[model samples]
Target: MATINSSIVIISLPAIFKGIGLNPLEPGNVSYLLWILMGYMLVTAVFVVTFGRLGDIYGRVKIYNIGFIVFTAGSIALALDPYSAGAGAMWLIVWRVVQGVGGAMLFANSTAILTDAFPVNKRGFALGINQVAAIAGSFIGLIVGGLLAVVDWRAVFFVSVPIGIIGTIWSYKSLHEVGTSTKSSVDWPGNITFAVGLTAVLAGITYGIQPYGGMTMGWLNPWVLAAIIGGLALLVVFVMIELRVANPMFNMHLFKIRAFTSGIFAGLLAAIGRGGLQFMLIIWLQGIWLPLHGYSYEDTPLWAGIYLLPITIGFLIAGPLSGALSDRFGARAFATTGLLLNAATFLALLVIPVNFEYWEFALITGLSGIGSGLFSSPNRTAIMNSVPANQRGSASGMAGAALNAGSSLSIGVFFSLMIAGLSSSLPGAMTAGLSQNGVPANIAAQIGQTPPVGSLFAAFLGYNPIESLLGPTGVLGSLSAQNSATLTGQTFFPELLSGPFHDGLVLVFVVAAAMSVIAAVMSITRGSRYVHVEEAVPEKGASVPQPSTRSV
Candidate 1:
């Protein structure tokens, strides 16, 4: 339930910007939109390790309950946001960050609690179900956001309120600690450095897609450059500190275990490919394709979610079944093969047209989802199985950090690439299209050159760019009513943008495909199965119990 709610917020965030009457493509507006969408993940990534360490020091269940409360409060605040543009965005951003802290607590401890509750032999099934819920929640958010955007944007946030309340009460009443606990000093220095460094890096990436001065992309912006460079430098220092600290937040030596390292790296890379690709696909459908195909922008979000059901369907079919099978056979073959299949699916997507046939697009996406589901369970189980019970909390946090960080990176990189591609061709195309539609040439040209990122965001938010650009004061103001109406009509702008938009999409898919292939190759290098020697036990009836069989 926590995973579902968290993911719903993630999927719904971009759409919320549009609901609040902001253009997602415009630099100022896009900045706010991006922060609102990525802030939760950013905060969650920064705090998960710290919270995981706390789970080990305090009780996991105790911290997890507090997470539920924080998340619920954030949801209520989001539903009640009273301003627009900057103030409204700040309110959402602050609350979203708080919600992320809650999500981190839940994410950091849920697996630990499950590991304590379930025996080793049955852990795969439990985790698989949990994984399904997480993925399902993301899809559910898209559907809900689309449906509620028509009634009121606030409905999406409110949806979580009742659920959060129920989940908090239920979790408090029923969940308890069955796992071992240990006392350790908090790694305050390590925590602060890690949080600030990651925030700077991610924030830089988020803004790097926005326009700066005359440049369409912010990568050249001095502040953004500093953030990226500074973030990397601090991370280097963080590693050095971890090696010397007694109660290090992150264990540097875990990479010595090949299975653990490979699993984590593969998970991170896959998440980078998947997370960004998901958003790009949603924008393609909701912002451009759906409107061009006859669905109103207002109706696009719900339908886009419905169209994406196939991906979730593929996951539903594969996750539990593969997890169950992995219990008997080692994860090596299944995991490697799954990633290979995933890489192939990415290549297939690269070749497909942006305005693709439904069946073809659905099949390809479903195939990718199946591959992801196949890889996830066994890979996670393998990593967990190879670690000592005492280290699971920290180990799990490390794995999760990789995934979350990869997701943030993917969003930044993919958005930059898409914007770059669109900027190269969209202006000329938009100018021509608008001119041909009876708009004045200068006005059309100016609007076309308004930066492709802004247009993309406008579509993402379900707002028509023509409406925003021509708002009563621009070129449309001097024109006859008939020309203005024709220029700003529902079909005019969507039709004008489709060609260049499709071009941008092709580039996005190619990048995703390459990333997926690299991740697959990395997964293959994990090598044969091995258990942690420290956890191994002597034969039964011997003087000492075997370390591997320490369940009792």
Candidate 2:
């Protein structure tokens, strides 16, 4: 439920904004869209580490139970939001942040709890199942949100209430402190710096995608620059504090474990690529392909989610199998080969046309999903197995932080790349297309000057870019009936957009592929499989052994 909620709102946003009586694409209201989309992720990234450390100090199951209750309460609050317009949006955003807090608590401790419960030989299979749930939930949320949005907007949030209630009650009744909770002082300074610093950098990246100083992106904005630079400086301070502090919030020594460090890096890279693929695919389908194929703007959101099901299907098939296999075969081959497959799929997506056939699109996406699933379980299992028992909570938190942080980073990186690609050609294309359809040259030029991000977002939110772009200008009302119909027709805008959108899609896919390749390199270079031993170190002359053929 926690992970599903992380992505549910994305597919439900059109209904959500409509229910709230707000026009989200309006310049002033754009932040509402961005905040609602990013707030949950941002809070989760910032608080995961701290909450994991808290789990270590207290008890993993205790904190996890509390997480369920808090999440349920937040869902209820969200469902019951009574305001309209800005107030309504704010209400949801604030509650979403609350949900993020609860989510962080659950994510930070779940892995450690599993590690404690399962034996080493079976840990990969156990963690693989856990990892599958974690990864697949994000994609599943899309389908669930679409189906629920068809019923009512509030159902998206309310759907979680009963599930959370059940989970919370069951967890409290059945779970107790199974892992040792070492008593220790919370590293307050380290916590403060790490949270603040990471938040600043991520928030900066988020804001950086927006327009400022008449440019397509805000990378040069003074505040964006300050936030990013200051955040980095503070992170430096955080590392120093962790090294010097006796009871560090994040154990610096964990990096010394080659399996742990390499796994984290590879996981982070895959997440970055995957997140970009999620958003970009949504835009591609909702904005360009679906509309061209005759789906209405309002219906595009749900269908986009529906169309993305192949990837989820592939993940469901591959995640557990690879995870179980990795236990006896080590992570090197599966982890590396899976990511290489992912890179191949990214390039495949690039090779396909913007308005691609369904089967071709599904095949490529399913392969990508399989790659992700294959990598996720073993990658996570390797990370957990390589860490000591006492540091498992912190290690889990750090890994979660990396995954969430990579997701956050992908938004900024890919959006900027796509926007930059569109900037060079989209304006001219729009101006030409609009002018040819009997719109005045001046009006066409003025509309063309609108930032490309607005169009990208319009398509992203399942709005027809042409209609959304033309609505505010009031020019559609003045045009002749045939001309207005032509301007608003699905195919016309999609045809005009195909050239520019592909230009942008190429750049986005290329970068995503490169990230996957680099990630695979990291995966292959993680040395041999090695689980940490707390009490009994390996004999002085002993070499790392091969993977066991033991069954659970």
Clash pairs, candidate 2, are none
Give one digit per residue, the lDDT tens place, for model 2 in 288-366: 8998888887788788889999999999889999999988988878899889999999899988888788999999999
State residue 115's C-alpha deviation in candidate 2, in Å: 0.5
lDDT of each: 0.76, 0.89
- TM-score (C-alpha) between model 1 and the true structure: 0.92
If scored against the real structure, what TM-score would every candidate get?
Answer: 0.92, 0.96
> Candidate 1 clash total?
13
List candidate 2 segments past 4 Å from native.
471-474, 536-552
Could you give candidate 1's per-residue lDDT for residues 374-404 as a string of tens digits? 8887777667666666666776677667767
